[model samples]
Target chain A: MSGAGHHRNAELQARVNRLLDLAESRGVITRGQVDARIEAFGDRVTARNGADMVVRAWNSPEYRERLLADAGAAAAELGHAGGGYSSDIRLHAVANTPTVHHVVVCTLCSCYPLAWLGPPPAWYKSEAYRSRVVRDPRGVLREFGLVLPNSTEVRVWDASAEARYLVVPQRPPGAEELSEDAQRDLVTRDCLIGVAVPRLPAEVSR
Target chain B: MSFAVGDRVRVLTMNPPGHNRAPRYVRGHVGEVVRLVGDGRFPDESAVIGDAARREDIVTVAFAGPELWGPDSHTGDRVHVDLFVSYLEAVGERSDGGRTR
Candidate 1:
């Protein structure tokens, strides 16, 4: 016995349809263009773009200096030029050192570097992560299987503005023996976000 | 720009209507401008106007844990938030004194 008391879903659908029609009529965007853009984003952009930047920085001190200085330009050097959605948006890189760890979050909204890092993960957009990270970063990192020593300072970066953040995890031990591609594989999205650090496959196996 | 790098400033506790990028947590908090983050479209305006919004200067503000929270907070812990220039105010001697959150 379904009641007609609330047509919330239907009403929302109709509103969405109306907005789509209006946008199409005004040439704001076409369905084909939208689909094409999504497809391009899925195909060309991925976390690998960010991993490439990290791997390059880990190997080259000059690249690391440039990345820490002008992250947007450093990304562009690797052909990951962001700033499509907002003409003024920039990418900022924070490097993790022996004594400090950097983690990023957008408390107000999911203002991620989608152009460079691809779409944000489901967990990233969740309210728990958004609200909890700023309040209890160390606990959140610990829950994520990352336990930091008391001496290591945790720097929580609240990306509340247009500038997006990328965390460069500290280079792992014995990483010098790894090839460029192998090193790239070590740097995952979580490593870039500072929730987890890169580990050699052997380390994980052991 | 109203403030430069190394300038000690306080984030304005403004509750402007409509969209805003200044997070509620950092409002009225004292922090130092670490670096100029370049100019960007103001979120309060761009959140309404997609492409026509004017750009404004942005800076990465760093706040100590004890300052943002309290004495109970971790001693060496620091938090950094990128903020627009307009959201920051110049601090004078003892300007932040007697201003209780």
Candidate 2:
């Protein structure tokens, strides 16, 4: 069934399109300019760039250290910073260990690490998930079918400021033998977000 | 502008006029700043005017579960939230005590 929020968003989109059309007709805005703006918006946050950063951190300890020490520069080193809508937001990387895990959330709104991880999924923006995760992270993770061992410490990072965060999941065992490109393929978006760890070939086969 | 990394501060719950990055669930909670994350143009003013707002220092804050959820909350479990300078107030100086949740 159609929901009120969805309907409102559709109406807003229509209004924006009409305004754009009028602006174009009046010579105030060009179609090419509008297309460029739309393209910019889409390119503003990209997951592929983020995945590359994760892969680099996985392979280069120096880059990883720099990422942990100063995330903004680490991202800039790869040409992922300073995009539209993302100019103000900063990115941070958190490394996971055998005993600890990290997850990202935006309790108030859908702020995400677009520079490194791309746009957030629909589930990330839902009020149900947002409101519940901060209060009961383990229970919510359980709902996602991620049951953590009692000994594991689950750290939740609430992305509230213009600053955003990405999880640097530990490289899976046996990944050492794989080429960097192959290893990058293993660093999925979920791995970057700390929802799942990088899967080894054997694990993937299973 | 008012708080820095390592400073202990509490979130204010008042209805702020502009874009706010603070979560409602964490309003009135006390936390310690873990990292000074640099600054950015504030969102509130930027949204109104097409121009980028002036940059302010951003900080990463660490909050113990007990401070947010009382004594029954898991001991030693902590959460980190990145906050803008405007969303926070000094712990004892304000009378409202960040109650807006």
Instruction: For each candidate, give its TM-score against the true structure.
Output: 0.87, 0.81
**What is the lDDT, from 0 to 100, of the residue B25 in candidate 1?**
82
Please give, as one word, the docking class of candidate 2.
Answer: medium
Candidate 2 chain B worst ten-residue window by lDDT: B92-101
Expressed as tens digits, the lDDT of each residue in B1-101 for candidate 1 is: 56788998898989998998888888899988898887888878988996688888989898888887788777677888999898988776665575633
Task: Give the 10-residue window scoring lowest on summed lDDT in candidate 2 chain A.
Answer: A1-10
lDDT of each residue in A86-153, candidate 1, tens digit only? 66677899999999999988988888878767888868877788877777778888989898898889
Task: Evaluate residue A169 in candidate 2 and report its C-alpha lDDT on the 0 to 100 scale.
Answer: 84
Query: Model 2 over residues A61-158: C-alpha lDDT tens digits?
Result: 99999988878889889887745665666678888888887888888778887656766777888887777666666777777656778777778898
* Model 2 clashing residue pairs (backbone): A46-A118, A47-A118, A50-A116
What TM-score does structure 1 among the candidates reach? 0.87
Please give the range of 10 consecutive residues that has the lowest summed lDDT in model 1 chain B: B92-101
Query: Can you give the lDDT of residue B87 in candidate 1?
Result: 91
